[model samples]
Target: MRTWNDSLKIGIPLLDCQHEQLLDQMDQLLEAMESQKGEQELRAIMGFLKMYINNHFNYEESCMALYKCPVACNNKDAHAKFLITLQDINHKIELKQSLELIVTQVKQELLDWFVNHIKSIDTRLQSYVKKSE
Candidate 1:
């Protein structure tokens, strides 16, 4: 179970905290799924993640645009795509897909995409912020 650490920080305290919380929630979602927790619990975590991700992405996108970060366009496109993927996952859940399938998708799509996005695009944003500062 991967956990948040300083290495994931993009030099923005608010976004960093949001990222940490997102990662923590992802872990809990995975744990609950693997432990065979109830559907209600899973839905609760999913609901929080859905809302939090939107807020986080909006703030991040605005910051990137305000800072004139080079990756701003890419960041926006990525966020849009992620939102679509999340919507698909939610649809699957509503359709009552198997828990194992949902877990796999969450791990592969949400968790993996998030870490990669942070390491690659968000790191570039951090560099821009540093230069601007």
Candidate 2:
């Protein structure tokens, strides 16, 4: 099930809202997979993933730069890599490749990256926002 757990909240309401939305879409995709749904369902997943990442990535990078984060560039690079991998995964799905392995990998990678990135990297950005307020 998709969740907006307290652990995922980054002390920024707007960002947290975005994260909740992204997770919801992800959960929908997972549910579709569990139901043996096919490529049509994956279309929405791909679209949501693309849109969410585009918008959220910008917000994150802007926040990082605005905060003069020491790791802003590194964080941006990591996000870019994630976007690329997400695209590749979608491509593989489109090619009628076995999604089971890809889905499993994506879930683990995304969850780990999301939690760590927000808690460590984003917390630094949040710290700046807090100090400025």
- Give the top-scoring candidate (lDDT): 1
Worst 10 residues of 2 by lDDT: 105-114
Stretches of candidate 2 above 4 Å error?
Answer: none
Per-residue CA lDDT of model 2 for 42-112, tens digit only, reads: 88787888988799989878887887878899899889888888787778778877767766856776655
Error at 91, model 2, angstroms: 0.8
Clashing pairs in 1: none
Each model's lDDT: 0.89, 0.77
Worst 10 residues of 1 by lDDT: 90-99
Candidate 1 local lDDT, residue 37: 88
Per-residue lDDT over 27-113 for candidate 1, one digit per residue giving the tens place of the 0 to 100 score: 898898899888898889889999999999999999999888989999999999999998888788778789799889989998989
